[model samples]
Target chain A: MGSVVMHNVVSVDGFIADADDEVGPLFEWYGNGDVEIGAGCTVSKTSAAYVQPMWADLGVLVIGRHLFDLTNGWEGSPPAGEHVVVVSHRPRPEGWHPEASYFFVDDVARAVAKAGELAGDRTVGVAAGDVGGQALALGLVDEVAMDVVPVVFGSGKRYFGPVDSQHLLEDPHVVVQGDRVLHLRYKVRR
Target chain B: MGSVVMHNVVSVDGFIADADDEVGPLFEWYGNGDVEIGAGCTVSKTSAAYVQPMWADLGVLVIGRHLFDLTNGWEGSPPAGEHVVVVSHRPRPEGWHPEASYFFVDDVARAVAKAGELAGDRTVGVAAGDVGGQALALGLVDEVAMDVVPVVFGSGKRYFGPVDSQHLLEDPHVVVQGDRVLHLRYKVRR
Candidate 1:
């Protein structure tokens, strides 16, 4: 099975977004550099090298329902991956993006399992939030990736989301400094 | 005047300590390696190289009263620095560590001013928390240094304290991967 990596761009204080779901300056790096990867996104060469391969290898993305509603499933075209698995209690909206390969699962574990099946040997990217936190707590995530921005959001939506217990991760094996972001990847300790 | 750097070891979730003021695993890296920096503290060679110079250049430390009370000002022997400035409304305890260069000040800005005066050309380290937040907000901080540990503390005392506004920092000029810790330093954008 492919590895499941939980990922997000977060503030220095660990907030993924503000209370109103605004990203503020968290996404600044995507446009701050001269290197263009794809989908109107340009980043530093250092970031492109670290992020492009990860996006290319993504076979599926698992996200929470909140994200699906927020981005409308990214208008049926995610940043990467051919398939998306959204964890939500509600079923997919009727007649919504019929051609899109989006799956809605009620449970986080089941969602990740379905993502794994869809990913095959490729990587499964899990959006970091409530669902990602649950997947991590269930020991379904293999790696944790963060694109740390330089701004601090004093209070807002946390990146870990609802996880109440401590989780230990191995030292980051990948550390790449970009224009306005630092990319770090740590393996979840078994 | 020397640079005023706010410093602390924080969890990936951006917490300096738990609600009870326990650091838990955040300080584990200080003793988890072979290279002994000083005062019986050992750390990875990578960490020592990055941290020793910072410690050696510290001529003064400014800390909030809560931290001073928590550790009793590290028993009058701080980890670094020749003088310790405690930010508190109350004066120092009568005859408490009189021989130690510990000063009690009633204001954050005043404490930092006194610290700078005492530090001269050496760096003045400020413990991250409420006082640190105020200092940063008041534009008294020159840099932010964090030793990020690989654990998630769901919710606890924040490293930035009650800072409610956004602050921009330059991309970290220093990023050192250490045992169980990632040493990062970013200059405060003026």
Candidate 2:
């Protein structure tokens, strides 16, 4: 059986995006090929050796409609060729096809279930902020990985919108990325 | 000449305390006999070998009246015996004395100035949540040091409150302390 996981980079103040909707500085440590993150410290290593294998194990992705639109439906091919389930109230965009591994669902639970069905033996990666937060609130997520950047933007959209309940997390797997990026992974306690 | 620095331990959600106003688990990494913090890392060393030396150089400490009441004027001996300036609008508490190196003032600027005058050649540390946020907002803080614990409280007091302006911080000093704690230091850009 596969698990569901969520990951994102957040600021020191816990904001995923600023007032201007900019996530560049928060992701400054990512997307570069030279930076390595693992083993509790940021050291130089090949991403293919450490990161690519994890992405290879992700069989599906659950995301919000906003993120789907932000990346143009991931240009027809999502990361690692994983199936994508976009949760939205709106109708699917024009000329969408299931053969392309994209599904538009109305709610979060259905999306998670659909992703589980689609994933077979591999894990489902939840990528949207609100969708991931909702999954965590519902106790549907198994793990959370965060890349905490050393920046405080004063005010912005919190990654966890307004979860009413408290969920404890187990001891985390922590690593430093680049010079100052903190990479933390925790198992959600049910 | 002296510099003004603000330091605090916060959760992953940027909370300094829980809703019940307790700082227990967030500071569990502190107070143990074998932890030392410096240049953004928490190492295993005696307090005298690490923390006390930093406090020994602090000539003054600017704090809010709320914190003064919380700790009973830091038990009449501020950290390092630094001259303590308590910022408040209310009258000083009855039986307060200057011989204890404590002063109560009505405004933030006057408190900073008095701290500067008292500090002389040594640095001044600002130790109140609202006062530190206010100093950062007014561009009076020279640096910020945070001990980031791995826990995430859903909500609490933000160390940086309603700052009227945005202040950019340069690259930070970071270190992992005692397994799960992160020590971060950032210099405020003027």
lDDT of 1 by residue, A1-190 (tens): 8999999999998889989999989999999888999979998889999989999999999999999999988888988999999999999999999999999999999999999999999999999989888888888989999999998788788899887778889999999998899999999989
DockQ of each: 0.85, 0.33
TM-score of model number 2? 0.82
TM-score of chain B of 1: 0.98
- Give residue B97's lDDT in candidate 1 (0 to 100): 82
For model 1, the superposed segments whose C-alpha errors exceed 4 Å read none
Q: Could you tell me which 10 consecutive residues in candidate 2 chain A have the lowest summed lDDT?
A: A39-48
| lDDT (tens digit, per residue) of candidate 2 on A132-166 | 88888877888877766766677876766455334
Estimate, for each residue in B1-190, the C-alpha lDDT of model 2 and write its tens digit: 7778887877766777766667766766554445545333344453235345666678988988888888888677875545889899887677765468788899888898899999998988986368888888777888887766766576777777655334566657545454345666688866
Best by DockQ: 1
Candidate 1 DockQ score?
0.85
